[model samples]
Structures are given as C-alpha cells and as structure tokens.
Target chain A: MGAEFVQFSLTPVLIGVLSAIACALPGNFLILRRQALIGDAISHVVLPGIVVAFLLTGMISAVPMLLGAAGAALVAVVLIEAVKRLGNIEPGAAMGAIFTSMFAAGVLILEQTDTSSVHLDVEHALMGNLESLVWLRAEGWHSLLDPSMLATLPGELSRIAAVCAFVVVATLMFWRWLKIATFDEGFAQALGIPSTALGLGLVVVAAIAAVAAFDAVGSIIVIAMFICPPAAARLMTNRLGHQVVWSAVFATLSAVLGYVLAGYGPFWFGFEGAVSAAGMIATVSGIILAGACVFGPHRSRVGVAQQEAR
Target chain B: MSRMAQPTIATDHGHSIDPARAPRDTALAIHGLTVSYGEKPAVFSVDAAFKAKGMSAIVGPNGAGKSTLLKAALGVIPRLSGEVYVFGETIRDARARVAYVPQSASVDWDFPTTVMDVVQMGLYRKVGLLGRLSGPVRAQARECLDRVGMADFANRQIGQLSGGQQQRVFLARALAQDADLYLLDEPFAGVDAATERAIIGVLKSLKDEGKAVVAVHHDLATVRDYFDHVFLINVRRIAEGPVETTFTTEHLQATYGGRLAATHLDELAVADGAR
Candidate 1:
C-alpha cells in the first residue's frame, strides 16, 4: 500500500514542480515591479473567462480554455489601468473593485448555467482534483511520438511538461529585457528598450502561467504559487538574477515535498483519503514565505548586526 | 514699489561695474512654449534665450513652473505648444547632449538599487537597448563617481545613503551622461555645506568646459556669488540677464520683496500674540 501511494505521488509531484517553475520565473519580475497582487487578482478574475470558454466550446480542452483565460486576464489588467487613468482612482482600490466584481460575476454565471455534465463546477475551480490528473492523457501525440510510448505516460503529465518547457524557454529568451525593465522603466525607455512591449509580454506570460496552474491547483493555490516562492527568495537576495534562480529552487523544493506530505497526511490525520494536493502545496509555499519573513537572512538578528557593522 | 527707484549699481570693495554688461548667446531658445497639468497651465507662452556656456539660475516662488520649465526643456513634460532648441539644434535632435537632474524628493529613496546602478543608467543613451555595460562605460561611471567623491561607496545601496550622498550620486549620474547641456532642479536643497560646495565646483568646471548649466536655485543670497546669470520668474520671466544687472532691488521687489515682507509681518504678529 505504501509503494502504491509512493507511485501515485509521481504525477502530482511533476505537476507541482512544473507549476512552481512556471510561476517563479514571472513571479520574480512581478514582485519587483510591485505588481505581485495582480497575480492574485488575475487568478480570481480568470474564472469567468474559463467558464465562458467551456460554455462556448462545450469541451474541457486545456489549450482553448487557457488562451481564453489569458485574454480575459489581459482585459482585466487593461480595465484596472483604464480605471486608474480615467477615473483617477487609487490602484489598489481599482484592482480590488474590478477583481471581486468579475469573480462574483463568474460564480453567478456558473450557478445559472444548466450544463452540470460539462464539469464546470465552482468547487473544481477553487480546489482541483489531483486524483483525476493521474488518468488524464494526450490524444494525438500517440501517432507522432510512438503510440506504445504514449501508453506509458499520462496525457495530462505530457501537457504539464509542455507548459513547463514553454515557460522555461519564454523566461530565458526575455530575461535580459525583463531585468532591464524591472529595475528602471525610465532608463529602459531611454535606451529604446520597448519597455511597454516587454511589460505587456510579462503580463501575458504571467497570465499563461496562471491559466496553466488554474485547473491543477485552483485559483487561490495558484496565487500562492505566483507570490510566496518569489517573496521567499526576495528575503534571501537583493539582486534580481539571484532572486530568480533562488525562487525557482524554493518553488521546486516546495512542490516535491508538498506532494509527498499530501500523499501521507490523510493516513496520519485519520481524515478523508482524498487529501488536497493543491492545499498542501500552497500551505508549504506559505510556510516557506512566512519562515523567510521571520528567520531569513535579511530579517535575522545576525543579518541585521552584520549589515550594521558593514 | 519705491525700491525700483534705487540705482542698479551696488558696489563692494570700491568696484563699480554696470550690471547689465554680459555676453549673450542663444543657448536655449524657446518659441511660444506652453505646458499644462490636466487643464491648468503650469507654464505659459514663453519665448526666451539663455546665455551660452555659463551658470544660469532659474528662481521663482513655489508652483511658479520653475521645475516645469526645466522639465519642458528636457522634453520630459508634454508641451501644449511651441518648440525648444538646445544650442543650434532642436531638443529632439540634441537629446544626447542634454542631461537633467530632478529634485531630490521627486523619487522614492527606498527603491532597491545601488548607487553605481543608478549612475550607470545615465549611460543608457550611448549603450543602446540590449547593450551590455562594457569596460569603457564602467570606467566612465567610476570616473563620474570619483569626481563626486562617491567612488568609495559605488556598490552601496542607494537607500542606505545620506540625503547629501544621494544628491551627490544624482550629480554623478548627470556627470556620467557627459552632456553638453545640464539642467538641475533644486540641487542644493537639503544638502550639506560640503555637498553644496562640491556641486558649485562641478558647475564651475562644467561652465569652464563651455557646457550650459541651468539650475533652479532657491537661495537668493548666493545668486550673485554662485550664478553668472539669473532669471527671476513668477509664472513669467520677470527679468533675465547677468547677476550684476538682473539681481537689482527692483527685480527683488518684483520677484519676492512684497511676499517676503508680508510673510515676515505675519510671523512677527504671531510671535507678539504668543508673548
């Protein structure tokens, strides 16, 4: 039974690791840009987008739904900016008003919809089913990458892998521009660095990352993935480059450890056997962030003394 | 109002030279320049040419568009109408030759960045987008820092620095730009005496190198000593010429005397009431 549990944990661990990487890369820039809260806002606001996509397509395909959510998240950002610019409202107030309204609208729409068999449940959007992930598989890849080989790996795992690869490549390609833009927008503009384009590109990437994690981890947990790891890394380093690398490390570690704990936690606690992998992962990430805030190098007494001496 | 009747010639050490006599060149020429904030005009239609390659001070009361004028000159602020020419060319065509130092309080000092990083940003014009900081650019940044006596603290986080040090770092950044025209706003405000001296020295050196240095100055007493030329402004140019000619009692009355007397009287009345 222990071996079965261990074997079953592999897919969740993989998803966790991939999601962590995907979230951490953009998370570093988002934190530096002072737009960390936007991640939380977008995660919640993308709900209506996902539901609308499902309603229109009448399918549970990840690609079309994620693209639709990305479009919606971008619109939400634009709306937030527009409200601030046009209405002269404070940014925090605008973000809070817009996201809550959108999220509530999504819930209302879901309740009114008659498609119960379509798997568009609000509970699924809040806390994902990790058990179902084990059965998820890719369809067309069997003919291209060896039909027999396709039988060995679940299709959802492959899709998650593809998402991770996309994130890694996108981050690498845009790292230089992102670093420049994050540090100083005026200087970036002076150099003709296409600061706005790079900024929008980052928002798009962040949206994509949020959408990728949305189904597997749900909205709240995805927000934790986007925020906690990078914030934890920020306490340890001041340099942007170091922050990115450390955040990726912290995120990957949290994912693997969280999956293992989720698998065993139910048996130990005498609770339902279907433990929430997303909750465990998010909780672990939160603990790490909180730990950094307390005992991390910057906050530690020793660190303060050293800095003072220097 | 009677202060205007006094002679412009005020002698010290028995030397009487006419204040109105100084060379003039079209250092900065503006044609009907206007700038607005929202709906209100901050700077109105102003056509003027500052003298070339000397220390020029722009003095005005608060909200008189002193900083706005500098910003407009730098093309940082959107002008409602008119064009600006630096030297013989348009500001757009001469962007690389101009550098601006904004007010010390304008930026959040707590921003996570090092002094060297901020100074190196001045080289953004020459480095180009995606351009890495090469050895030469690093050397130039180092040189600028050294000139400002900030070479020892190049790697220090800007937030950790003293106000004077931060101001010096900003000056160092302007120095790094190697600009032919420098515009600074309130560079002396809240700075130490040493920092003030260092700033004046840098300005003098820039002038000696035949670069135009225009500063928005607050200290009226030092205007005669520090700046070779002065522009007394109150939403409009009251008078502009060499300090000897323009720093007259009439100009002082026109710019600040009445306002100063009223403020002083109010302060004295409050003191008497307290007693």
Candidate 2:
C-alpha cells in the first residue's frame, strides 16, 4: 500500500493541495468584498485566452497562458462594466450576462482554431485530469530524494507551486491594504488609498490563480475554493485574519480528505475502482460548507429567531 | 444673517454661490452643480456656500435631493457638471482635510469588522498604504470611540450592535478622521435619544473648534435648536442662511412643495429634551 501510494498518489495530492491553497488564499478577500462570483467568470473566461494564445504562438508555454488568462479576465471586467452602465442593472445581473457570453466566446474560439492535435479539449478544461500528473518514474520513496526525481517533476506541480508562492508573498506584503479595502471601500477612497487600482490588482491575481490551477484541478476546485472555503470560514469566525486562516484550513482539508475518499470510498459502495478525485475534492468542500452552516458557533437564521423569542 | 449676506455671483462654472465673505471663511462651495440620469436632472444648478464655524443642516422634503446635494459634493456619485470647493480648494485637492459620514442604511452592518477596525480606517491615510497601525494610532482610535461612548465595544463585531450603536460607531470613525470639515448624511436618523444627544454634542464641539459641519437633517422641530444655518433644498437651492431666518414657515412650505407631512410637537420636545 505504501509503495503504491508513493508511486501513484504523491504528485496528484500535492497538486490538489497547492492549487487549493493558491485559490483559497485570495478567496478570503473575494468573499469579503462580495465579488466571489468573479472567480467563476475568470475560470471559464480563460479558456478562449488560452486557446488564442496557443493558436498565435503554436507552442504551449506558461507565460502566454498566464497573459491570456489575465487578458480574458480584463475583457470580462470591461464587458461587465458595460452591461452595468448601459443596462442600468444590478452587479449580479451584469456578472451573469458577461460570464456566460465570455465563456461561450471561449468555446467558439477553441472550435474554430482546431487545436485537437494537442491533448486539449473542452471536457478536460472544465474538469481537469488529475490522475495523469505523475512522478512515479521513481523506483521508490528514496528516489524522490535524489536529484533525478526532483529535477524531472511534472511541470503542472511546479507551475502551481510557483503561483502559490507568488500568492503567499503578495498577500502578506499587501495584507493591511486588502483588509481595509475589502471592509470599507468608501473609507479607503476617502483616505486617498488607490482602492480602484488595488481592486484591479486583486482581480488580476485571482485571474493568475485561476489560470494556474485550471490545469491541475480544472475549474471545479478553482470556482469552489474561490467562494466555498472563504464563505464557510466566514460562518466560523468574526475576524478577518482568523477567517483567512480558517479558510486555508478548510481548503486543505477538502483536498486531503477528498483525495482519500476518491481513492478508497468506492470499495465501501461495492465498487472496485476509485472516482474523479478533483470532483470529489470539490464535493468535500461543499459538504464542509453545509456543515459550517449547521454547526458553526455563529448564529444562524433559526438561532436569531430563537433569541428574539426568548 | 445680513452681516454675511452677499449677492449670488455666477462664476464661469455657473455656480451661483454668495462669494461675498473673505474666501478663507467659506467651508464648502458648490458651483453650477447638475446631476442627471439619462435626460432627467436629479439636482439642477445647486449653488450654496457653507461657513467654517457653524452647524448647517441641509433641510428638504423626501426626494428633495437633500442627500443628493451632499453626495454630489463629495463626488460619491457622478456629477454631470459642476465644481465643489472645500476651503477655497477643489475637493480633490483638499480630500484628506474633509470627511464624509454616509447614511447608516447604506452600510452592511453584517460585515465582519470590529468597531476598532472601522475606526482605524479613518487614520489609514495618515498611516498611508503598507504602514502598520502603531500604538498611538490605536490609542487615538480608542479615544474617538470613547468620545462616542463606544470605547467598551472596541473589539465587538459591528453587526452585533444596535441600530443606534452602529450609528455611533460610524460617528466615532468620522471623529478619528480628525478632518477640518465634515459632511454627514442624516446622523440623527434611526438613532435613540442618547445617541442623538451624544452626536449633537460632538457636532457642537466641531463647530466650536471652527470646523465645518454640514449635515442632512429631517426633523423640522429641531431645526432652530440644532443648527446655526439651514439650506432649504428641493432639487435646487430654495434658501440658505442662519436657521433662525432661513427656516421660516414660508421657506419650509416652498421646499416641501406644499406637501407637508404631519409631525407632532412631542418629537420636537424630545429633540429639545435630549439636548
């Protein structure tokens, strides 16, 4: 069992955890600012950005993918703004309209470009192929220590780790500003803080996170960690710093537990094979959110009404 | 009132404010201000000037653009055409010296923030971006909260507070700003008698220190008792001067567009007794 784990499970689990932390670190701010849905939009919108970049460059590289993702997110923002201004509608309506259209644009671009020669398709875009990421070329766990296993690691794992590192550094460096801006934008503006630019910077970072995580876990975990863990953490605490920590814990828990259940739970159900680990991880996070809603220390709707009655 | 009266001068910006006093004394000046939605104007040609040493209330009926006038001046909303000057400089140039307290209803009380966190934001400009909150900044924030009787609730989540307590927290935040001029939207709305008294005392102290206090007020009975000056607004400036003179029954009727709602004298007595 230990040998099999070392051979087949190590890299996939690592990828899942890295992407979860990467997405959830910035997810706290998105939930705080009530812009969580923007992540879902960006995750879908990056499709066309990646496809177009592939067509133009004729090569698949990390830098162009990052740029394409960021550019598509910018277009989504502009389209959302246009809908908000011209239609005189609420923000939720604008986001819904723009996200769908941009995602459809991505599909059309991929179809027209005919890049099927590569191992890329729409199905693999929405739901990632986590089982394929492997560093099992090593003979044993001892080989993982050698320079060969370390040097020949999967690019997906390295890409996610770099993105995760950037997220951690950027979040820590600008922690105070992000907190203030998320809590009260008007107050931030009155104090001469460049809130607009800061907001844009956050969205760009979120785009980068979504883009990087898309390949390993696909869009499911990206959209889930963007909103679910932060929201669940919000139900657990009243402080922003604590909320961030709690959200990371929840995301990591989802990744780890989901991997275990996906690999082993089918036997309990009388099946011999494992399931989709990425989807299972996203499902675990959803279950955690539901658990927080019922059992967290914070007052729920029923709790508030009971207090009023007392 | 006559000592400060001057002809309404139309500047090139089309503002019809009274520029008679020394330019240094005016606290806020709005020139040729017009805000429109599509083709309809919400506020049209609003030109009024406030002084630095008095409590001025923008009084008008519901939908009379009382809040609109203040919001437009602060540039919180879009202004199709106009200039807003604070201390003889454009609002953009004098932003740090000015503070605004939006309506309580506009805020999300359920937001996960402590009273101290909210108050500390007022001093963030002083700390600038990337600066940490030092001991002195936190101390000053506590002092502001103490002034409004919310010092005990510094660490308390804002969502758990009562409506009146929430309003007081916002006031403490504005106090922490320590700005030379303050614009408040309905500070008295939804607040209890004690919070109202505390707020009025704070505003009075601001006036005594020669700072400008422009507020959106609704209770007609307390107009004379609470404010030194009044601006009767109804999509445009109907009248502007000391509350004793500009708050006449004639001006009130015109500003309300003859659709006066019935209010009892007991509310006026409450406003008086609270003070």
Worst 10-residue stretch by lDDT in candidate 1 chain B? B15-24
- The numbered model that scores best in DockQ is 2
Grade the docking of candidate 2: acceptable
Give per-model TM-scores.
0.82, 0.88
Q: Model 2 clash pairs? A: B15-B32
lDDT at B225 for candidate 1? 83
Model 1 clash pairs? A137-A155, A138-A155
Worst 10 residues of 1 chain A by lDDT: A135-144
The backbone clash count of each candidate, in order, is 2, 1
- Encode model 2's per-residue lDDT on A26-124: one tens digit a residue: 888987778888888888888888787788888777678768877888899888878899989888889888888878988888887767888667877
True-vs-predicted CA distance for residue B255, candidate 2, Å: 1.5
Model 1 segments more than 4 A misplaced: A1-8, A135-198, A268-274, A300-310, B1-27, B48-52, B88-92, B249-258, B262-275
Give model 2's DockQ, 2 decimals. Answer: 0.36
Ignoring the other chain, what TM-score does chain B have in each prediction? Answer: 0.84, 0.87
Model 2 residue runs over 4 Å out of place are A1-7, A55-61, A108-116, A137-149, A268-270, A299-310, B1-22, B261-275
